[model samples]
Target: MAARITARRPSPERRRTARMTSSDWANPYGVRKPYGSNGANHGDGGEKGATLSADHPLVPWKQPDHVHQWVDVDHSREELDRFVRNWPDLGELLDANVGHGRVVIVSGPPGMGKTTLIHRCLYEVQQRVAATGPSAGDPLAVFVPTAGLENDGRRISVDPDGSFAPTRLINARIRSEITKKLLLHEFSESRVRAITAEEDPYQAYGEMSDLLVQRNALLFAVIPHIRWNDAHLRAAFLRTCLSHAHTRIVLFVEVSHGAAETAREVAAALSGSAAVTHLALRELNSEDIWRFSRSARAANGAPNGLVEPDRSSLMAAHDEWKPSDVRELRKVFHSAADALRRAPHPWPIDADALRPHWERRRAGRDALLRHPILPRSGG
Candidate 1:
């Protein structure tokens, strides 16, 4: 029988010391509290707000897992169809790269849903793996957000408690756990070997290379904004990963107007690598945008009797909600979908335009409920 692991209880003195250390690392502004602890009082010198509760919106859910939803990129079904259909190309590219030990770089402007597309591909691959099992050797996708890594490496102001109060400690913990799980799941045996190997700790890339070699899994590294100076190192890593025939890698760099030059430089460096395939994320066409919105609405179930209004209805509603322009409307719809997924309670639709329709439906239901009272079977 497998041995059971039990939780260990810490002594009061240890708990107090831990709390003090946590408080020391907490944010001065107290915007972000310590994990499992509350913020320090801003007005009072004493730690007044130290209650443990699930008040933070970012806290992990304790009940049923929420479903995922999306916003329409724009009002375009045709474009969405194209995007979904084109997703297979990514898988094909991955398979081809894995065969030859190559790298595929996905680069695009911010808000183009590059990360979302990556997640979608990973989700599909996971489903396939679930259906076919390990014998099929389904490709594993790991996302490493560079921003999180940078934040982890950067020094933060700490309090006497040795805690990061203002910093997003929960977010950091969640991300760390995610990264840990990905690494463990992808390279279990290789990880053990890497840890046991007698190598200089400073030369960490070599260990990563070893892990990749052992697992034969594809790594999806997301770098939001690429820097010109980091190009060489990034290129080196890609070259190393692709040196082995079983390892496939992809670097998704998200760029914006301010970082256009950096994107250009990085693109140039990646271009020199024969193993890398670079693709830019373009804006979604109107049809694609529409489809995204529709899909998001459908995934969230759109509520009973809340028929997804046609594009015409949206346009009409857009005219009425003037100050809340089309852009605002889109944002609201996106938020609504997200709420439907993440919110604990069913999201209520209270928009002035939607309210009347819902009210009418309620009235019809009430009438049906009263039908039995108005007429008897004999009458």
Candidate 2:
């Protein structure tokens, strides 16, 4: 018994390195660094970056803060109800455009949630059309994000079939969107192929519109950042509108204070001097920011988001920072959430708590600017 107790001679298998579960391998005293599928390190959450579970308290910060990013309110109704600041104004504009061949201009300052607002409104319009239309299926809402269209004006893409495509940049984008939506809705697969094969964007658009009309379904042609000076582009858009006389055309224009007159001219021409509905978004106030941030978190499934005291602290911090727009404010929130997720910090974080993060970010940015690449050695 004494000899056996001295230590059972380890078996060959038992002598091997002990197997450890992932939890045992994880650092107990420090944050576990996550790696994405590409082997890139991600420290935003215990999981992949921006993929935190819905119940996570840091969920709100996961939202993309870019001005051009369109939030799909169809999938996030809670966020739509909470963050959409200009719903009443948008409702009136959409109400006027229903079943009418009219262009509505949605104007707002940069980063004022113009794109998000339009997305939510259009989603609502789609739902209404789906529920009340004579069609058996959902309506089609085609969005053409013509970013950098000014530089890529009328540029053509070489097709895979080794032919020069006649479709312009915006029109081609529309065709692609139509084909994608049709396939998603399980519409006629043959029709999807036909739309994809069509070389003329306008003709493809007309054909798609005709199909939708036959189903008595509504079609929304949403184009954003359309300037008034692009006569050729505007004429092309007009042709599409003319072909689909009953389609809802929405032109989302970002309005700078200095360019008010230019925006008005754009609204006039795009509307063809017809009665145009206008929905203008105002800048976010302090309360709006607070409420929006809270709702954003809640929308992401954080039912226990910032309490009243925490919200007050956040608002004070935001006021002191004086973020120029919602976009900047979002960046602040995202950074704060990221920091908290990395290390569990006390609740109701104030300016003092957030200053370190800002300083670190500034230092990192400065270091990058000072030396974007490693210094070269003498050859």
Top TM-score prediction, candidate number: 2
Candidate 2 accuracy as TM-score: 0.52
Candidate 1 residue spans exceeding 4 A from truth: 1-102, 127-179, 186-206, 212-220, 226-253, 256-266, 272-274, 284-289, 298-330, 334-379
| Global lDDT scores for all candidate models | 0.36, 0.41
Highest-lDDT candidate: 2
> What's the TM-score of each model vs. the native?
0.43, 0.52
**Residue pairs that clash (backbone atoms under 3 angstroms), model 2:** none
Q: Tell me the alpha-carbon RMSD of every candidate.
A: 22.4, 15.5
Compose the digit string of candidate 1's lDDT tens values, residues 132-184.
44553654555554444222211222223544322233223323333464556
For model 2, what is the error of residue 317's alpha carbon versus the real structure, in angstroms, after optimal superposition?
4.6
